[model samples]
Target: MKSLKLISSAIAMLMCFVSMAQERTITGTVTDQSNVPLPGVQINIKGTKNYAQTNYDGNYSIQAKTGDALIFSFIGMDSQTIKVKSSSVINVALKESSNQLQEVVVVGYGESTSDYSTRSYDRAERKKAKTAATASVALQGKVAGVQVQNNAVYNPSQNVVIRGAASVSPKNEPMYIIDGVPAKANQMSKINPNDIKDLKVLKDAAATSIYGNKASNGVVVISTKNELYKNLTEQELDKKLNIMPIPSEPTQEDYDSFVENAFESPRTAPLSTFSIDVDNASYTNIRRFLNNGQQVPKDAVRVEEMVNFFKYTYPQPKNEHPFSINTELNDSPWNSKNQILKIGLQGKNIPTEDLPASNLVFLIDVSGSMSDANKLPLLKQSLKILVNELRQKDKVAIVVYAGAAGMVLPPTNGDEKQTIINALDQLQSGGSTAGGAGIELAYKIASENFIKGGNNRVILATDGDFNVGSSSNSDMEKLIEEKRKTGVFLTCLGYGMGNYKDSKLETLSDKGNGNYAYIDNIQEANRFLGKEFKGSMFAIAKDVKIQIEFNPKQVQAYRLIGYENRKLRPEDFKNDAIDAGELGSGHTVTALYEIIPTGVKSDYLAEQPDDLKYTKTETNSNNYSDELATIKFRYKKPDGDKSIEMVQVIENKAVALEKASDDMKFSSAVAWFGLKLRDSKLVSNKSSEDIKKLAKEGLSNDADGYKAEFIRLVEAVK
Candidate 1:
């Protein structure tokens, strides 16, 4: 009987292992209505991490247990989840997204379409760079272990040093890759301010080793925004809603969206806090409209983004913290009676050579929606520019999605330029868009090839016309939010126009620990991929937040200029779990406030009620000084989960607008432009001529010709 009991126990244990390991291989093909196989589709067991990527032929085999649900998904197609009973075969046929779109056409690689909307093609925000308007300023002083040196406000190049130079090469510069292609340090400086999204800095041996011998220096990665920026309505652009635009038209759903932000009261709500918003898409989109001779929309103009888009030339940071604090109080250009309190944060700059290795996935959308020459073709050329700047050690994988998603290239060394280029050339546009599946597969590829402390990212380039399954902005956003937890970052690049869904793209980029850029042409792409690669590709600091407490004794009412969307609750400033914008190496950020002195009377100020019947009014403490306000912010190292604190105090003394530095005047001019564009009640008396004159006068240190460009854009509006 004892022997029988022992045998029974053994049998029980054996059965347990069998049940625990009840895994079976499920094979299937994902396809569209045309019966064409889909590649790179994502197949996985529901509620499990076990997932598989389809091969080039759209064939997939995934492991799952009996009764477990298997999910199959494509980007623009409906997703299918099947429960495993006994059958191992699970074929899926995905159709186009049923959600309506405004005739977004996709042509083959070789064809040129007769689209009438080509003449008005346009589209796309982020971190404040230093004294300079460029992104490098924002990245400075942010990294804990890295040393950054900022150039003059106008100088775009920054010196970066990583993990104590173990070994050095000729230039001792780390290679940079933006969106999976190699790039030069200076190329990072040229990207459009609004086009940028996130930066990835790779350091240490484990991360650097992947880049081969060259990585002995380090590597920086840049991700651009692929989401929509702005699109004109068909009736508004072509005088006929019946004649749809080339890309897409804003739908009734989009037009029906409502958003509003009210002014704050200094009497009761004296303290103001918000997440820093570097997204400047509003400014550029305004330029496109004006250049096309179209009237600007009030809802589209974000005052904070427009003002923050220009550089303010504040003093660079000198302490252990990432950004330097610079404050200036001056009379407002729009309202001389009001005081303009300017606060500038200059993130320490790090030279490019000192950065780390990288692991990158180039996720390109080849869906029929991206068939325009400005979309797919332009995307290819832009990626080529980035590839040319790569080091032999960097690794890149190409993932494309359309009617279905697929991996056209595995992890190939950067030096294998021919192979990479050939793979790019072979890509063609057709079929429904499987954006969800594409993101899943691309991230899967990135995670699989991820290096423990390296720059791991997926650069997603698309036209923002997701329609198929799980294509809702919320669904795709949740998907990216979940994936970013795995230590992978995203860069979204928006291409083409019309069908562009700016809200969808911006949300995806924001949630994915990445940045967004609208690539209207190769010039913008080169600026992002070639010139500003360092600042564009690598992040030096993350989760940076700011809070300000005004002296109600010295100020009665105040308003922030451009960051309406970045407002945060005071408590959120201390919560490390709340993610904020990132600062790139040498990146700079600037903010402006229009304040009404305590003695001045302004209609915008809140009416003070007689001492409440239930309680006495509170009096100000420590009110005897000339201090204007106290500014405090929190930041964290790139990979850290916690944030560090930083505080700064300002004076109440005001300077004349003319007496202020050129940085102030230029940014102020941009602010007025934004206000005028929005028809803000605050700037009713201001005119475009005033803005143009001030912008021209403030064009000091115009080394990069950007100031000149601004002047031209302003003039075009006339």
Candidate 2:
């Protein structure tokens, strides 16, 4: 019996050793010599079928055992081989190959000969093309480095390698420009190969050079005979696509255009009414543009968002109201002759533990457009971070939309984090974007499992490339408007770059009484979803509106910076039927107004029109000359429809620009940068250097380091 026990112990010990030798998941990032993330870098386990490719953020996870050799390869970069050691994390920075120039042609357009390797498959030649479901499959072996893996009759996947892998993006997928507009490679899955007029694959760098970094992997130009009209203008194309623009890359991304606000005479328009904005999508989107070495779009530069992106040191609300208002008047940094008035609102902060129970629905887009590594993959990672912050009382449901909308995870307690994460992991991207359908299903789930008087919200994550049912901006706006009455708020989190639809997402969030943010990287995910969980998930006030009554005695004319889209009719301020912005717990909102002092001469102020016929202008009888502006605001409780009014008066006082608080200086610098980006005629001759100087002055004890990042962004402008 003793001998038998010893034998059993030996067997158990051997089993443990064998288990330890089995494949384990290893994760790491790949970058270039300059520490820039390299997407599409191919990583493989030597002598094994296990492999993984880096996502848009240069991150990857693979199944490999200890002591196994891993090979990393990308075109134009030196190959690297590393053996797994004790650590599961392996990071590699590849160096450019010395003989890369000989192998790769420089990508440029308008060259003398335009002699770069190019292949064209005209309609006549492709008449007998294989009847494949996807464009990639149809092109099969015709194009070099393009291979189709037929796993099953129903699941045939294609992988296109254009002159090997390029680390320009997170994935090795080439940019697909359909007609004159740029699109994602996976979008071609929806197009019929028979409808293709001319399919040309540009393999040389010179042919793809026009697209800059977006074409690092290569460029595939597709022309559809029946679908697209040749030589359509940008406006016509945008109208035809029915998509909003997300400006960054020179792509089909759309943005709403608006002329700059002209100086308004307090005498003509006494009440300046508008909604308070808390969304910061514009700022981060602009940052992506600057980081990618592209010009920032003028319409994309929303000054209010840029100013509010950084955290401010405003005092917490101490009254019955959910927020506290503070105002400061200082000399305008750009126009020395004019004064800049800063209005700030600080929402009451609530501790995470004391926050109410949350019934959160994650509305994720798993469409073909979201197939980019930065889109679906990054979104999953971001949501996981939020899951970690959930408390036991909090519940989460996941609703995904592709060709249709469906619920993936039921309402599960936040404590069941592993289960939620597992569901997220199983999600794959394909099919058209039925964004409107997705929103309907998400709202249904939220309403069914409604947590009365608790934090009920739907967080929509997508690139906003909606093409299927109810996808247009007007349709989405009307849909969200109806849903906002359900007392369930919405939050739009935008991801990806090329072919991003910022306008649609903006409309959904704006009408749904929610906030919007653009998640550019994992760090931004941490900032928006993790670090700002209390503020992002819990709303202190809803339908918040601001109406400023300028004092004609102390001010001549003033123009509110940004908030152009949020402008409300003078009578809309009191109407409870109209929707406005929301204020979250611990959130801070800042607005700047360029004011021309009563006697100050300014070029921005157009010649005052002659007195209106048969109209008499009446001045305030309250004799409040000591006040520069009377600010009246209204807000409703998160669950209430009625708004409570509050009023504050800005004293007619001016402080030197140097005497302003750090927040004032930093926010001003950001506003200046925004105006500069927009090429506004209001700004005096100011260089980026001047803005950088002002930002550095306000770089006082920035714990989050956001202020420092702002300074760096300004430096990247030129």
Candidate 3:
């Protein structure tokens, strides 16, 4: 009987493993009965929060387990439900429904062709608003995450901004569509509340991407009960909507251009110096591009950021320092002849209750460009998550900027949770951005409420589109550089797309002695703000710099991956005035270097220069032939100014790729994938399949499922 029980337990364990492995990626296209692609079709996995929408090409990819049900829905189209089976691809064809065709309208992109509507209010629901003073007021309780702000003292008109929908313009107000004719926010109240038959709101990028720049603040489609337009056909509706074309605006998204690091002879340049980067924005931003079926721009693929996003098993610091250093050597997966070196830093983890008090100032951008669901709205949600994680000893203040900057809330104790949330909820996006003014005021507030030895920081959340006073990148950089001298660090949380200015945010974080992250979705907010609150909120070390000297005796040529923007002169490593990146509590940073051993012959090597006729090259004679490289780290305490240094030596031995640790393998895979994305000459022949296979080999300790997600992203690339 005991043996029988043991056999049953073994079978149960196998079943559990099978169930965990059953969750796989599902990809397909949504089309109409005529074989025309239907973009913005909302696909939801039944009984779960997992949801996705078709891109411009009507393509989508989602994750689900076997036997899961997926519901495909669109406006004016019959919704269909399908059960997941063994197949990974599920194409759906939605049929048009005449019954509800005239009752509602769906608008996407600029294609007059209706595809989907996220939220709608029919006549029955509209009746609830009949008692309200205006149509905008009626939508107060009807729409989710929608707020109607009325500055009665200044303006009588209600400023309606959707907190659930994201936009990328200075016009924070929603665009009004009256019977297919576009109208302005002021005209929203002019329309009689009783004349509306149906009202729908489009908030997601998939639904709004086609609407162009004018709709960046979101679009509200309304169908009036006018008998004159009651019997109009879909073609007539298109004609009426096309009366005014979407405003033409060039894409203002900005990313700094950088050339890949080229291999350098150790004999000529032995030291590689750079700041330690803790920012993981590039990885999440890259995932956003892949998930949307868009080609990632080469500038967006920061190899160091990608490799450092995941956590590794580095031991904690037992010494007086705030972080631990680790190193590993292994065969390069992409190039068999070359070797790869991994350097990792693990910041000491401190429990939230035990950490020092925090003095945080939420410097939010409520400009017109931040009106989108993902911008101001998502920003609010992300902040609320952090608020819940705050302790009573911590303190927070709120400052906002648009046309001007001012404090909305004074320094309040973290225990007043609801009060802080109420202030965040009341914020409305409008006017052009004055990021410089915002920074000035935020730093002032942080300094006033300084918690001597606590974590004092200004959290700036925005799309980085500063357009009003002092909006130039140079102006912002100088402003931030001055603010850092106050000993109050900065943290930039970027949101939205299209007009996103990554270059500006990066500069602010780098010069202000802080970290930067891009929040793409609510899930990302939870990941960066909720699960990793300690690391994202508190800092343990500041001005962290790394310098490594490769011995020519064991290494021929070497190149550091990424960090093109963070590189520093060898002399700057010891300069206390020189600013660098910060290491947050419990945060981990990883950097990789591709090295060519002394005997290896490769194409990457440049032609040798004239044999240096006057200078004879010297080889290491210190009897340290087994040492491949010596690395040095410099960092200052969170509140201290002077820097301390640490050193570690990497052995010359290289382990086989298959025998390397999961972290070494995973980091190598990430670096290779980043190189592949950038189309780097070093990895020109490497394919996506190669990245996927390498990533799979590093999935042993992925309890958080991030490693598995990385593999799926690799496979998603076309």
Per-residue accuracy of model 1 over 1-718 as CA lDDT, tens digit each:
9999999999999997687568666777888887878754667677765666565457766667778887776543567778887787888887654431222222112222221111110000001223222333233334544533333222335545554444311123556655555654555544443454555566656345666655555666555565221233323323321223342224321211324344565667867887766555556555555543456667657766666555556666777887788888888888878878877777777765566566889999888877665678678778887888777768899999887788999999989986787677556687888889889899999999887766777888887777776688779879988997877777788776556666676777777877666675666677667876765667777777889988877877778786665678888988877767777666667788888887887776556777778865465675556888888989887777888898878887888888877888888888777777666776645666778888987898766665666776675454
Better of 1 and 3 by lDDT: 3
Which regions of candidate 2 fall more than 4 Å away from where they truly are? 1-249
lDDT of 3 by residue, 123-164 (tens): 221112222244565454345656564423123346676664
Report the backbone clash tally of model 2.
11
Cα displacement (angstroms), candidate 1, residue 259, comes to 4.9
- The CA lDDT at 130 in model 1 is 31
* 2 versus 3: better TM-score goes to: 2
**Candidate number that wins on TM-score, 1 or 2:** 2
Q: Over the stretch 119-164, how does candidate 2's per-residue lDDT look in tens digits?
A: 2222121123342355554444446654333222222234455666
TM-score for each of the candidates: 0.64, 0.72, 0.69
lDDT of each: 0.67, 0.81, 0.80
lDDT ranking from best to worst?
A: 2, 3, 1
Clashes of 1: 100
Once fitted onto the true fold, the runs of candidate 1 whose alpha carbons sit more than 4 angstroms away are 1-261, 615-617
Which residue runs of candidate 3 sit more than 4 Å off their true CA positions? 1-250
